[model samples]
Target chain A: MLNRPASDTQITHARRLWLYAVAVLVMAFLILPTFVVIPMSFSDSRFLRFPPQGFSLRWYESYLTSPEWMQATWVSLKVAVLTTLLATPLGIAASYGLHVSRVPFSRVLTIALISPLIIPIIILGVGIFYLYVRLGVVNTIPGLVMAHTILAIPFVVVTVSSGLQQYDSNQELAARNLGASRWTAFRTITLPQIRGSIVAGGLFAFITSFDEVVIALFISGGQNTTLTRRMFTGLRDEIDPTIAAISSLLIVLSVIMLLILVLSNRQK
Target chain B: MSKLSVRSQPIAIRDVTKTYGSFNALENVTLDIAAGEFLTLLGPSGSGKTTLLMVLAGFTRATSGHVLVGSQDMTRVPPHKRDFGMVFQNYALFPHMNVFGNVAYPLRLRRVSRSEIDTRVARALDLVQLSHLAERPIDALSGGQRQRIALARAIVFEPRVLLMDEPLSALDKNLREQMQIEIRNLHENLGITTVYVTHDQREALTMSDQVVVIDAGRISQKGAPREIYERPANAFVADFIGESTLLPVQAGADGFAFGGRALRATVAPPGGLFLVARPEKMELHRTDMDPAYNLFEGTLHQLVYQGETVLAQVALPEGQTISMRLTSRREVMAALPEPGKPITLALHPEDTVIVPERGQ
Candidate 1:
C-alpha cells in the first residue's frame, strides 16, 4: 500500500491531516499548562488542586488585596517599563552603527552583545550579583532596571538587526541625494521602514524583563522584590494558591504580547 | 503646467582615483561634462563606470582628486550638500509611503510650503504620466510604474544635476525603449546636467549626447555616440561599442597589411595595429566592385535568418570569422551563397579604421 501511487486528492488529504495532528499536539503541549493554571487559580481549595470541590475568587482577591503581592507587581512593572525605554533606543543605535560603519571587529562586537543570550542564566545571575554588590546597588530599583536592560538589549539588537538587514540601504542614499541631511534621511526613510522591528524589539524587551526571575532572585530583595521572586518564595515556603493567580495573569500578559507580535508581523 | 526652474551646471572631474585596499575601483579618471548635456558612462560590469558616477554624485569619495561644479570645488561636499537628484537601479521607493508622499519628500525636506509641495509633486507625476496613481501604495505598482515613480521622485525637487545608474535595467525591453525616449524628452524640457551609467551599449548610444567608454577602471574613449561608433580610439573601444571583427594588421612604411594584402587606411599606426571592420559597414560583393573598397574572400560558415536582417558569418583564410548583417531582401537572400561556399565581402577604406593595439 505504501508503494502504491495515490491520487492528488488523497495525497493532499493525507498530508493536511498529518500536519493538523502535529499542530494540535504542539498547541496542547504549549497551552495546556496555562489552561490548567487558570482553573486552579479559581479553586476553592486551600492547596493547589485541579478539578476542585468548588470554584471561587478567593485566591484572586487575596492577590489583589495583599500589600506584599501588590508591591511585587508594582516593582516588576516599574523595572520592565524602565528597561524598555532605556534598551530600545540604545539597541537601535547600536544595530544601526554596526550595520553602517563596517567596523573591522563587527562580528566580535555582535557576539559580545548577544553573549548574554548564549551564557547560562545562572552564571549571568551570579556575575551580575557580584558586580551589584561591589557597586552597592543590590536591592535597588535602578539596580534591578539596569540588570533587566542588560538582558533586554540583546533582544532589541537581534530583532532590529534583522529588520535592518531586510531594509535597502539605497533608500537612505536616495534621500540624501534629494538634499536631505543624513539624520533626516535616517529618521524619515530608514526608521519608518524598520518601525515594525523596533516595535517588536520593544515588546520583546518588556516581556523579557517582566518574566525574568534568575537575576532578580540573586540581586533583588527587601522593598524591590520582583513578582517572580515573590511567586517563587510563595510556592517554596507558604504553598499559597495566590501564586497560581499571579501565574495565570502573567501568562495572559505574555499571550497578549505574543499576539501583538503576530499581528505586526502579518502587517509587514 | 508651470515650468520649474532648473539651473544646469558644468561638472569637472580631475584625475579622480578610488582604491579599495589593493583593488582599484576607479583609476585616475578626468572628464568634463558640459551644462545641459547628457553624458553616459558605458562599460561592462566591474568597469568602474558606476564608480565614476558615484564620485560625481558625491556618494563615493575619490582617493585623490578634485570635483568642481561650475567653479566651486565640491570634492569634499557630502551628497546632501551637493543637492543632486539620483535614480537608483532598484527604484528604492519607500514601501511605507504612498506615491505622492515619496515624490514630495525632497520638497518637504527643503521646507517648501505644503501647497507648493503638492503642486510640484503633481506636476512631476504629470510629467511622468503617473498622475492617476498618486495615492497608490508602492507595493501595488508594477515594475514599470515603480520606475516611473522613482523618476518622478528624483526630478521633483528640480535639482541642478540628475544622476541615473542603470535606471531602466529592471524593466522589459519594450518598456525600457519607451522610457528611454521619455527620459530623453524630460531632459530636453528640464535641461538638467545629467550623468547616466549603464552596461547596455544600445542604451548609451540611444540616449547620450556624449558617451564615455570605460574599461577596467579607466576610460578608453569619450566622444559623441556616432563618433565613438564610427571612429573608436583603440581595439578595446572598437570591440566594446558595436559588433566588429578586429583583424590583426602588419604596419609598415606604406600602410597596413591584413590577410596578406595591402589594405587602405585613413590613419597610420605606430606599432601593433588592428583593422576594425564593423559588421554593418561590410557588404557582400560578387567581385571587387569599388576601387576604394578593400576586399576579402571567405567561406560562408553560418547564416542566421532574423526577420528583417540576415546575419552571415564568414570564415577568413586566417581562421577568423567576421559577421556581416544584410537586409533580408529577396534578391539579396537569393544571391547569397550556401554554407561552405566561397564569398567575397568588401569594406570601404573610409569605414575601415586601423587602431594601434594596446599592450602590444
Candidate 2:
C-alpha cells in the first residue's frame, strides 16, 4: 500500500510543467481577440480602437438608445429563445427514437437529421432563402426562427445521443417489470438520469441561434433584422464603435454559457 | 405483517421456441412450476436458460407457445401488465433515487397511499436488514448492499412470481454463499413461485427445489439437486453438474459393461454408453481387489494434495487415466502408493452412474 504503481495517466500537476505553458499559449491564441474588443467598446473616438484614446460609455448609450439597434436586439433575443424551445424537444425525440427503434434505415435517418451541420452555410442560406420566398415568409421573425432552429437542432441531437449511449437501457426494463408502463418508465427512470445532458443541449441550441449570421442575412431584413445581421451590415458600411460594444456583450453571454456547461458536466 | 397478503401463482410454459434467424435459442421448451416452488434454469452462457426466463417474465415473446399464470393465458402479456417481480444481473437500482425512493417506486405507480408507501418501503427495507440506511444514496452503497437494495425494490410490491437473473455473480465467493442462504430464506418466508436463472451448478443446487439443466437450446435433465448430481441423464449433464471423468462404456440388453466388466448402479434412470466415476466417490483400494466392486487396474500417476483432500491420478492400461480423491480424515491417504506403482481403484455399485453420450 505504501508504494503506488506508476500508471499510464499523465500526472501533469507534479510532472510535465511545460504542458501547462503550452496550454496557456493556446488559450491566448484562441481567446485573446475576444477580450481585445472589450476595452475598444469604451473608446470616446468616433471609430473602434484596441487601445482607447479615452474611456467613455458613449458607444453603449448609442447601442441602447438607437431605435434600429434596439429593435434588432429584441428580434435576435425572440428568435433565439423560440429556436431553443422548438429544436430541443425535436432533437431529443429524434435521438431517442433512433436509439430504441428496430426499424430499418434508422442510421440513415440520423444522418439526415444532422445533415444541416455538415452542409456549407452559404449553400444552406441560399436554399432556405428560396424556400422562404415560395412560402412567403421572408423578412419575418417567424422565418428567422425557423431557419435558426434548423441550424440549432444538430447540437441538441449530438449531445443527447451521447447521453443516451452511456445509459443502460436495462434500467427502463427494470422499471417496466416493476409495474410501470412503458411511458411511465421512461419519464420516471430514463429522463431523470439524462437531465444534465438535456440541459447542456438546450444551452447549445440557444447559443447557436443567438450567434447565427449567414441564414439571417439571406432571410431577414428591414424590421426583422437580427443583431448579428445588423452588426454585419454596420461593419460593411463603416467602422463603428457600437458593433464593438455589442460584440463584447455577445462574448460575455458565450462565457456564461461555457460556465453552465462546465457545471452541468460536473453533475454527471 | 400486512406484506403477507401476497397471492403466489404457478407458471406453465408449453412448447416454447425462440429463434434468431437460423439459430435456435430455445426449442420446444416446456416446464410447469408448482405454486411457491423455487425452480432454477441452469445452463452455460447462451444455452437458452436466460431466454427461457425472459419468456416467463414476458420480456421475450416465444415464437410459438402458451404461458399460463395461475390458469390464465399470459403469452401476449406485456411485462408491465404481467406484475412479475424481476431482479436484473447488474442490480439496476435507480441512481437518482435514495434507497426509500427505489423501494417505493412500484407502490407509487400503483397509486398506493403516501403513508402506506412509506410504511411498506420501511418494511421491505427491513426484509433485507437494511432498514437503517433508507435515506442513503444508492451510489454510496457497496456491491453487496446494492444487491440487497435491488432485492428489496423487486419484492416491495409482493408480485406473485419473482425472477432473478444471476444476481450474485458479481459478488465474491464468501459474499455469494452468504447471499445464497439469505435469498433461500427469503423465498421460504415469501412463498412466491420463483424462477431463478444461474449457470453456477452449486448456486442452483443450493437455492432451488428443482434444477433444470439446459444444453444447446433443449432440456437435457430436470430433477432435484441430488438426483441430477448423482444420476445425470446424459454425458453432458454429468460432466456439467460435477467434477467427473466420463469413461466410455458398452450398454446392451444384457446390461452395461465398463472396462471388460459389468456395472450395476442403483441410481435414477440408468443405462447409457458412458460410466460416470466421480473422484470423491472412488476409493484407493490397498488390499486385494474385491470382485463385488467395479475395479480397474492402473499405475499411480501422481498425487495432488489440496488442503482437506488428496487426489490420486491413476493411468490405466489403454492410455486412459482416472482420478480418486482421498480425504485427509481417512488413514488410507498415507497408504496411497507412489507414482508408477501398480494400483487398484474401486467404486461401489451404488456410486457408479451410466449416462448416454451426446454430441457437444
Candidate with the greatest DockQ versus the true structure:
1
Candidate 1 residues lying further than 4 Å off, grouped into runs, are A1-23, B286-288
lDDT of 1 by residue, A110-139 (tens): 999888899998999999999999999999
For each candidate in turn, the TM-score is 0.95, 0.93
Superposed model 2: Cα runs more than 4 Å off = A1-21, A101-109, B1-3, B267-271, B286-291, B358-360
**Fnat scores for every prediction:** 0.95, 0.86
**Per-residue error at B8 for model 1, in Å?**
0.5
Q: Estimate the overall C-alpha local distance difference test score of candidate 2.
A: 0.89
Model 2 chain A: lowest-lDDT 10 consecutive positions: A1-10
lDDT of 2 by residue, B1-360 (tens): 555456789988899999988999999988889999999999999999999989988888999988999988999999998989899999999998999999999999999999989888988888899999999999999999999999999899989799999999999999999999999999998899889999999999999899999998999988989888987888999999888988888775667877777776664244467788889989876466666788878999998888798888988886778889888765676687778899988898888878777532
Whole-model lDDT per candidate: 0.90, 0.89
Could you tell me how far off, in angstroms, the CA of residue A175 lies in candidate 1 after the best superposition?
A: 1.3
Best TM-score among the predictions, by candidate number: 1
